[model samples]
Target: MKREILTLAFARAVSVEFIATLIFVFIGLGSALKWPSALPSILQISLAFGLAIGTMVQAFGHISGAHINPAVTIAFFVGNQISFLRTLFYVVAQLVGAIAGAGILYGVTPANTRGNLAINALNNNTSPGQALVVEMILTFQLAICIFASTDNRRSGGVGSPALSIGLSVALGHLIGIYFTGCSMNPARSFGPAVVMRRFSPAHWV
Candidate 1:
């Protein structure tokens, strides 16, 4: 375990997780902010998040597998695709990166536009149980897509895994935004909540 962790490639992968997550959170929340010029639409926010994840995946997938979300990382581990230590380190890195990204956005954004930093919460009177199920189904689809697209054991072409994964995220948001603000990834929600210093009960769900 020690030898594995000490390897240069392992260190590089961990670092990439942090950097990729930081960028993902920064752009995703930045796009959702309430600008003085105009309020961002749901389609805009969904596409922004999708584009951010897709771009990061394309850029860093080769380096670290680019699991920007903790849920995806955990899912990979649960599926026996990665070791426990790797999953643990990746989760920590992603969380730290998310907080750092949200912090930086908080610093750069105008105060009036911050508006909770796009923190996920229960919307449309969604019950915690209902939101929980919604989140599970949405995350399940994304995780399955990630696993299917990136599985090296596959022989045939997958046709742009990054785009597939990204569109999956956007597709989730299209329905999820009306429910729990679309928290398919725990890190995505946790980061902004920590930065904003507030979290609702549904956040736990």
Candidate 2:
């Protein structure tokens, strides 16, 4: 009976991660699609990602912790919060979900407007080293925010972890977008790159 319960919980967690990641990538990338009539500003794009993530966290936090990003999953694992098997499952689910989200966006969007599904890339004049540093810093900030806001011991002091996390994401993108297209999440960068078949060597960094 204990084993069965654990299995059920695992399944629920995986399913929630997959679905939440899919929704996050879909809405976040969709916001960056380039329409001829109106292009989204940096602020708009940031808010879109922030709100999408916040909404998912609120919807799924109780069930699976809403770990829609592999980086977040790995962080939790490193902190000894999740088992190795669970971490592996979450990472695989996140990657698959990201690909599915990007694929769906490709299918539904007009070819001219898709814009490589918003794959992360370094802007001109930015060196690969610079981009890497920027990505690391951005992701670190986000990860720290997530840990602080979601920690149950500190949860009482925070009004909404979801909102705080979302704001952190938005803050990262608001600045990082200018340099590395703001890919704090590897799954977010990987999904669109896989769908578009556009891989930059720097992406692995």
- Which lDDT tens digits does candidate 2 get at residues 121-157? 8899899999888989999999999999887786357
Candidate 2 residue spans exceeding 4 A from truth: 1-6
Tens digit of lDDT per residue, candidate 1, span 148-172? 9888889888889999999999999
On a 0 to 100 scale, what is the lDDT of residue 182 in model 2? 93
**Where is model 1 more than 4 Å wrong at Cα?**
none
Query: Candidate 2: minimum summed lDDT over ten consecutive residues — where?
Result: 1-10
104, model 2: CA deviation in Å? 0.6
Q: Candidate 1: global Cα-lDDT?
A: 0.91
- Best candidate according to TM-score: 1
**TM-scores of all candidate predictions against the true structure:** 0.97, 0.96
